[model samples]
Target: MADRTSKKPPTTRKTSLYRLTDDGDPDLRSLIRPRYLDQEGFRARPVRQGPLRGLLVTGTTAPGPADWCQALADLTGLAVNEENHTAFGLLIVRTEKHIYALGHGMGHLMIEPARIDPGFGIHFAVRCLEKDRVTKVRRQIMDARGRSDENSVTSGEHIRGFGIEEFGEIVSHIAGKVRGIPLTYTGGDAAGAHITGNDRSVKLRLGRTPEDLMNDLLAIEEVCERDDPLPEFDFITQVRPLEAVSDLAQGLDARLDEMLGTGVPGRVGLAVPSECREGFDSAETFRVRVARRTRTVPELDAQTLLGPVSSCAPGERLETLRKGKVQMFADSDAEEVISGNVSAGRWLTAEVVEEGAHYFLWQGKWYEVGAEYLATVKRRVTELLARPSRITLPPWPKGEGEGPYNEKRVAARAGYVLLDKKNVHTARLHGGGWEVCDLLGPDGQLIHIKKAPSGTAPLNHLFAQARMCVETLKYDTGARRKFIAKLDEIAPGHPARDFREPTVVLGILLKEGEPVTADSLFSFAQISLLHTDNVLKGLGARLEVVSIGR
Candidate 1:
């Protein structure tokens, strides 16, 4: 590929140059963000050793060396030698607004570091295997292309510098996508493997390879542990579908409305603005969709960075914003649901962590919940604690721009209708830091819930949330007004007036399929069950493990 622009940057300079140069090039910033000290006003200065060394953030208020060094240590979780100036070969220093990093071979984070365009670099990928099967394949490819020297030193277990070739009869079913690029790497070195291609040259490599390129395609796709024929319940217990509980609530709500006729109130409903209230039809009152930035899910914005809800989308059920499985519903209504039950159609993360799991070794703490499911549960619990509105997944899918895909690159790509919920919102008392509970229940009862298999961490997290909800309600009596107001809006006719209070019945929907009780997940998570009962009893709320299987 030819270098198009003639404007060349100055060499042997400070970090400021990279920032200035990067502003005109968004791609440069993207490449630098993951590896270097960016945006924080880094300046380049000469160092005693290494190529064009010395990097630092510039500004009076910039964080200092202690902070940057600590950040580096935290990032890698490795100790650093401040005096030696060598850890990751990095001499990291930070002032008020300036931070500097310079290491041997140029650590790829500098503004216009050296000898690299790094344009998403070549997607070189090679797998490390104990065998040399790729050698014959590479030999065949070289012969076909009339090339030689298959064992070239520069092509050390890398995806680049190799012609795309057939993956052999064992894996010949694959299709090639990158035009004019081979899809296989048959290196001679059985001791090493890699999948790397530099962006410096498109002639070398381009586009993505199949994800499981090295997954011993010779074997059956599933050689072990397929879903048991007895039931999906055990697996469901291990991986609780977070959406399933909401679905049950919604399903129950829908069933109740249908059974009781016209205006008969149900346990679930949404509280949107009176004007937007019409969107919540009698049948659709079990509003499942909420804002993308709702409290239950992870908040993406920096200001709203209460916690992380990093999505592993296109997940088990093929649920992802990309797959159109996530629900980003259209709401020209509110920022979040003021008070309501989450519905079935809404997008929610699936719970994969069994109850009472721990990571005391990695976390270095006693009884820490260590599963992705629990992490998600914590966020959802936060949402429930906030008493949000019903949220839809695939939030109003916009074109390829603001939404899943935008092959055409439309004008409103990534566009979303920000309903004016900020205007008609209600008071949601924020609780202190807490973990996720599985259940998201009505406002009047014990709020926030989670399902835990046989473990103490999840149960602890659940109990803590139940305790917090009790405390919040006890402290914030006026919180009930918001709850009452939501009931008035959704239930109508003041039917909730007959409802009781203080004894909010928070349900932890168990994976206990009917006719099976003793071996239920709740039993496994019973390590802290009695303690949880004692806590909730003392705090003044009810906790019930209500199982509704699929």
Candidate 2:
């Protein structure tokens, strides 16, 4: 009857350093090397004012400016300025608690002269509430070791969380705890209730507690409400034994053979041979009855008896069969039969039976046909046969020091595989520019012949176009094949030259055998060179590899 739930303790913090100079070694000059004093081609310059500062809120009814500053204090221990405000943008809020810090424009924007500004510092923060009712229950369970009574305590806590809507789950859980007989709840408009069992019925009140009802239900576990008894025979000695005998006599093989013989007649007669006659003479003779065949009597036909056989040919005749006034026969063969009626005066080379049925003799066998159904089957078969096999190229190797041997591989390996070509192979060129090469298969088939372009395009557009091409190739196998094949078709008069010249052939080029340089790999992968240049410069690679004409 007591309140069982408890609260969780507050979290603790870890150690931190205020400043690097606070260490015992105060010679900060040792951390500064001679290279730090040397002025490189480009130097890091701090902005006059750092990143922008702003307060992001859900709505006007959102927690006041003080709440925003307070949350910031709790999160970073830093004071936030909330007095001055700027324009706000309306964002589509998809959920109850999901709200984003918008309009900062840090990463997803083009940096131009108009976009650049000083004294802009964006300080974004989030505030969330922590609830701990269930957390306290978990902590208590962890602390209480090897205790059965603790389980009941937790179960009571769980029941408190259950509302009226969860009545079924709560009843099932309580029933499981008591190991009581299953009970189903039923009620009508008059506030009535009943508990039904196999042999007895009990009228029950709707307002009793689950625990009390569970106790009563278990006490009458054997009692049931109704007895709609099943018809009984001597099951063990009579019914079951007879069924076992039937199953043994009609084993799977005999039953399957009986099913197969349903519509078919046996070709051979059953007779005792001379060798087996001696054994059969001593054995019990179960009288075997042979199936009788119906007699076939010849009927006289007017044409067969009065005229020559050729006048009323014995073989099927080719005739144009018609339904109503429409002539349906398309071609003729004497053995083909159209079994249906034909319009008089219509030419018929094959006999037509009905609109949906016809018979044709091919290779000495008669084949029945359904016109529309046959056409549908032919179409589906054609489509299945025409579907092109999807071919997936193996993933390009990752990391450095892999793939075919090359002497000038130190810089990087940049190449493209002509995936749709009959023979797929990677083409890698050092330095830069388009080069013609014969890509042959093992059997010497010219799978792909390509002439790639040289020179670099603007940094921003290079990666975007490469990604577009890769995505386009993923869905359009024909277009991918055409693009690869176009490489071979590049002539002086071709229109591709204009577009090809302005674009940078960006790709990772590995030395024939050595590990590809990080700079070259970035280029090959078509990552934004401008954005990654700062990072790559730190790794001892030239930020700018070569000028277009140089």
Candidate 3:
């Protein structure tokens, strides 16, 4: 027995991070860990399902059937058994809208002559065991063996006795029953499978799908499911023309054989007749004609023509045959003649020569012609002429200063200046407002200056004077002592950083051929001069050293 007490009012609400299924079971965990969850305290929620579709089809053929069985297996993945002459397999047919399949298998049977009434040689029974819809069926037959069977062979006498009309009727009856059935021809009786004809060939027929077949068959289970139902048809029914069907079946069989071989059909080549050749005088033209059939001149027959000749130059003359003999003359000199003739369409020979205004006696008559006429005759004789010569130019000059005048120095001398301090003097020169000079220090180290100078100062001369001062002061004890005392009193900081009132910077140019010393105090004094130069150069100002005192 338990005692009950009044419940207290709820103070807060609770929220859940874990999710449960519709049946209240905890949701399952993921098989893989998520990258963001590597920190160890993360979880994933449930996802929803979407739509899906698929399909399948299965079929089988009779045992001992070669061509059709092999073709079906290759194209549709159906399996076949020789002993059964039957096949059983499936097709997984898929499309965007849905997934489905069809499964089927069948056995074959031979009909007795009595039952196959019209007496067709042999009759085969085919049945559709399962399908989504009625399928199209095609049939064909060939000699399973290369020759007729001895056991089933009929004598010509028996065939004649049966009568042509009777035999025709038997064939008709057999064809009618096989019309919609899927059939194949093989060597031997129903037991042994030998493909007939060349490589045991036969015609292939397309089968109608179950949907288009008899309505009863269309009610079979969906393509994706397995369902069985038997549909029967007579084996002696009349079929359409077999010759056309046979041709198609044979083609399909051939394609199958090709596919089985190298997985691709072999290619065949075609033949093309060679073209007629054309002739020309130049070997270049002849070679071209051989490779590419191009005739430069239509009238120049390959059998009779020769060269491409040219006429005389301007103001040239040649002899004119006005009446078959050298009759008239014309100005200038004549050039060469290019002419040729053909013989028997086989060989071509040509000649070239120069023609002038005057010629020796021919047939006892001296002939004279104007230069112009000779030139014209020369032009007519030569079928073509070489191009004119080109003009030559003089060579270029080799050494510097041998060409144009250079004003680079004029631009360099724009600014100049001179400075003096405590009887010490210096000078500077500017080009393009830039300093260019060689500087020296007290310790004998030469310093080179090459930069834009400040304002109007002669930067080069100023540098030279500063260098001379350093060197001159180095050997004079009294002067050095005084300079050192002045430097010690002056701060070595930049102008902007110097807090001392009346700070004066001395701008000096070290002279050429002077020396520089490694003494720290002396170096400092020289550095101060360099700093002063930099400040003046940056500000575009000019400066002069006034004095050096103790």
Q: Is candidate 1 or candidate 3 better by lDDT?
A: 1
lDDT of 1 by residue, 1-550 (tens): 7676875543221211111112232132332333344333343333433222233322222233554677789789898645322212223322222222323223333333332322211111111111222221122110111122333333232222233321100111111112112222322233332222222211211112222121212111121123331121111122211122233323432333232222212211111222222222112112222224333222111111111212222121112211221112233233444334323222111111224443111010011222553444344333333432332112122222221211222112232112111112224434322221222223333233333322223333454455555565455555545445554564354322322234443333332323113333222133234334445556555545433222
Q: For residues 311-362, could you state the per-residue lDDT of candidate 3 as single tens digits?
A: 2221110111101111011111111212222111121111111253232111
Question: Candidate 2 at residue 374, lDDT?
Answer: 36
Ten contiguous residues with the weakest lDDT in model 1: 168-177
How many steric overlaps does candidate 3 have?
Answer: 112
- TM-score for candidate 3: 0.11
Candidate 1 stretches greater than 4 Å from native: 1-46, 49-319, 322-347, 350-512, 515-519, 522-535, 540-550
* Cα RMSD to the true fold for all candidates: 25.5, 41.3, 46.5
lDDT of each: 0.27, 0.22, 0.22
TM-score of 1: 0.23
TM-score on alpha carbons, each prediction: 0.23, 0.15, 0.11
Question: With candidate 1 superimposed using the best TM-score fit, by how many Å does residue 98's alpha carbon deviate from the native?
Answer: 22
- Candidate 1 RMSD to the correct structure: 25.5
Encode model 2's per-residue lDDT on 240-332: one tens digit a residue: 001111232224213222322322112101122222222221232221111211111121111111122112222211111111111112123
User: How accurate locally is residue 497 in candidate 1, as Cα lDDT from 0 to 100?
Assistant: 34
Model 2, backbone clash pairs (residues 3+ apart or across chains), number: 46
Q: Which scores higher on TM-score, 2 or 3?
A: 2
